[model samples]
Target chain A: MANQPISEPAQKFGERVRARRHELGLSQEQLADKAGLHWTFVGQVERGRRNISLHNLLKLATGLEIDPAELVRGLRRPTG
Target chain B: MANQPISEPAQKFGERVRARRHELGLSQEQLADKAGLHWTFVGQVERGRRNISLHNLLKLATGLEIDPAELVRGLRRPTG
Candidate 1:
């Protein structure tokens, strides 16, 4: 596990969003609407370009029909 | 109850950190050093004045010697 390439936590977070959105068969626009966030903001989040706040994290979790922790799972220390 | 006073999630997050830090007998400066973060950043986070990112969240969790999820538990829907 230590040998795994280090990935930014933001990238992992974005991947989770993409995976969950696909699992729910929801487009970015649909997810954005449900989360009450802008589509561009969703894009930024999904691209790991935004340092999303706790409120937005909760909104996204609610939109994804999951707990907030679920969105943050599997985030291990980044390797060198 | 539904009448519970609405509190921002950031405040709740900060409260958790404060509570946990006290429980662990660690000062903010100590925790900041352990988390490899600035002491001022730790203070800001504890005050709910910072929109902390996932990376920082993990660092805080590590510093607290707790799971990242633990830091976020009990965060309910903000009552309005």
Candidate 2:
């Protein structure tokens, strides 16, 4: 997650990646290979340190076997 | 475009948004209102300076009268 941008949205995105990865029981390295991303990037993304591209986001959705919308679930407005 | 993320991927996404908006004859402010987003965010997104969330993506797709995949058309592997 070194030197990656950590915006509020990006951080939430990373959190979702970790949560989903845990639910799927896949390691970061495994997810990276399937998504065709560098391991470091994947790590950063999971840690909410980097923002991902739409292509990589699609790849992650495909790799996670989840709907594209699922990745954005993190973006929902938090209930007060 | 404030101090937003400016990756190669973000650039293409912005370009796609601009192209689609032109094709639809809509402005960034109009699209923002329809999509229930901030005008600045819309401008930033159209400039590829921000990575959008899935919810916003859905709203954009809906407001633009296009399919979800259409928004992702820019993410396809370039066959150069």
Candidate 3:
């Protein structure tokens, strides 16, 4: 068995979040405010530097006014 | 803004994880072993008692041989 980090999916997820936030015309600070999170934390999430928790995932989805599933759409299993 | 915990989605995700694990004929311990997680942690996830982190979510998805997006499918915004 090979062990590979799932960084690609995390990066892709971050990109989706960034794109959606842009589509909503929101600055990271504004999105963070809407999500009841700190701007730095949101930035870290956008950069895929941290693993987001489910609670925060819901917060992001609500802040973006999208389905939670939408954020993770099209993320296939990354090959190791 | 009304703040409601996203317990429903977490529960739904947990149910999906549990179902997938069962479909693969995996006990909690077995799944946990495959995912490199503790059995107690897997149990908590299956019970939706804790918010799952993205890293662990990926691990669970990989252990179940499914795409990560499938874990979050059909999770709508929980009403406040």
Candidate 4:
């Protein structure tokens, strides 16, 4: 599971996190501290290399000062 | 990490998923099949016993036939 390829949803989620971090003028280290996560993990998440858990997802949203829902606002399920 | 006690967000998320699944008239087995997860895993998720990954979260939303954001629509970051 750790080595699974990144999915489109993961990529988009990473982009949203990166954009939000930029909007807040925070560095990856700063966001990591605020989110109670490691800087390396934050970097991984921003690069879409981690399939983030719900707990960390909420922490990231808190660190970003946004509603948790906002992080996933525009994502849609892929159609078959 | 695997043994962490269930948090409020996880509990709430589970409740939302259960409600939606019931609304859709789907059993845990049915929902699991739709979401491409194991039935036991789906049961754990509905019971808030798993710290679900973002990938599976999206899958669950798709199985529930709702927008991914809808699963998190009213969730807010807890204030410190």
Candidate 5:
């Protein structure tokens, strides 16, 4: 309830990570390994089915080889 | 160091957050309260002293009432 906005940004962050992975031509398995996350969790996040913790987000950032700040930015209200 | 890139981006992220807090006219103590972080840690982060975790970043985002994605983007390679 209190974290509603957090959830939206959290899920949106997943979208950003998935997009970056695809853009870099990396698969979920590869990214999972690189980021030290479970392969299933990677898929879960990408599909917006998982609520990832901060540790996992850090792992995802490490796996994507992108700045964690970028992941934070990716959750923004994109100016359409 | 192994985490060199992460560290650089991590520090850069601190700069972004610090800028945001200053722009919002929030003191470290106030921001810390909003973000649920220790006041000392907030100070450390703004000064690029302590290495923050992803969880803290999320808290910071909430405190600033901005998208976490924006924080992530803040770590981008400025096109200057």
Candidate 6:
């Protein structure tokens, strides 16, 4: 799946991250610093290019100062 | 971090998964089939030995028949 287009869920997750980052007025670099992740990784995550791990998700939630559940709230498996 | 013990958050997440699985009276193999994941992987996840990605997390939540938020609800960053 390398180089394939991002999946819809990934895009949605990225949008949430971007929206939250914007709401907090934090640049990608700043968020990365707070999350102890690379800015490039943060950029990829915000662009739906990375399928982030739970640990990183927690880090991101911490960086954003939100409950970890907030990031994944309302997300569900697409019904057939 | 190779061979390190499971982190507290990972353990908590695993506990939630296991508890939910038990509540539904599903075996690891059954849950794995529902989640479209390998049974060994499901075992690892239940043991907190895997830091699973968001995609897989969704899969697990779907298999467990719960909102994604429920899996992560109440999780927070540990304080110093």
Q: Which candidate achieves the best lDDT against the true structure?
A: 6
DockQ for all candidate structures vs. native: 0.38, 0.14, 0.39, 0.52, 0.25, 0.66
Report the C-alpha lDDT of model 5 over A1-80, residue by residue, as the tens digit: 43242355556767888899998899999988887778987887876665564446667877787776677663432221
lDDT per residue (tens digit) for residues A1-80 in model 1: 52232357777888889899999999999999998889888887888776677777888887888888887765654444
- lDDT of each residue in B1-80, candidate 4, tens digit only: 65442776777788899999999999999999998889999888877788888888988988898877777766654444
Q: Let me know the DockQ for model 6.
A: 0.66
Encode model 5's per-residue lDDT on B20-63: one tens digit a residue.
Answer: 99999999999999878788878777665545544566678888
lDDT of each: 0.77, 0.69, 0.79, 0.82, 0.69, 0.83
Tens-place lDDT per residue, model 2, B8-68, is 5566777777888889999888888877778788888887777665556756766676664
Residue A69's C-alpha lDDT in candidate 3? 77
Ten contiguous residues with the weakest lDDT in model 2 chain A = A71-80
Give TM per candidate.
0.80, 0.53, 0.80, 0.87, 0.55, 0.89
Candidate 2: residue A53 lDDT (0-100): 57
Model 1 bad stretches (over 4 Å): A1-7, A77-80, B1-7, B74-80
Q: Write the per-residue lDDT of candidate 4 for residues A2-71, one digit (tens) a residue.
A: 6442877777888899999999999999999998889999988888888888888888988999877888
Query: What is the DockQ score, from 0 to 1, of model 3?
Result: 0.39
Candidate that scores best on DockQ: 6
**How far does residue A17 in candidate 5 sit from its true spot (Å)?**
4.6
Model 1 chain B weakest 10-residue run by lDDT: B1-10
Error of 6 at B38 (Å): 1.1
Ten contiguous residues with the weakest lDDT in model 4 chain A: A71-80
Model 3: per-residue lDDT, tens digit, A1-80? 12232377777778888999999999999999998889998887788766788878878888888877787765643445
Model 4: how far residue A57 lies from native, Å = 0.2
Q: Would you list the clashing residue pairs of candidate 6?
A: none
lDDT of 6 by residue, A12-32 (tens): 787899999999999999999
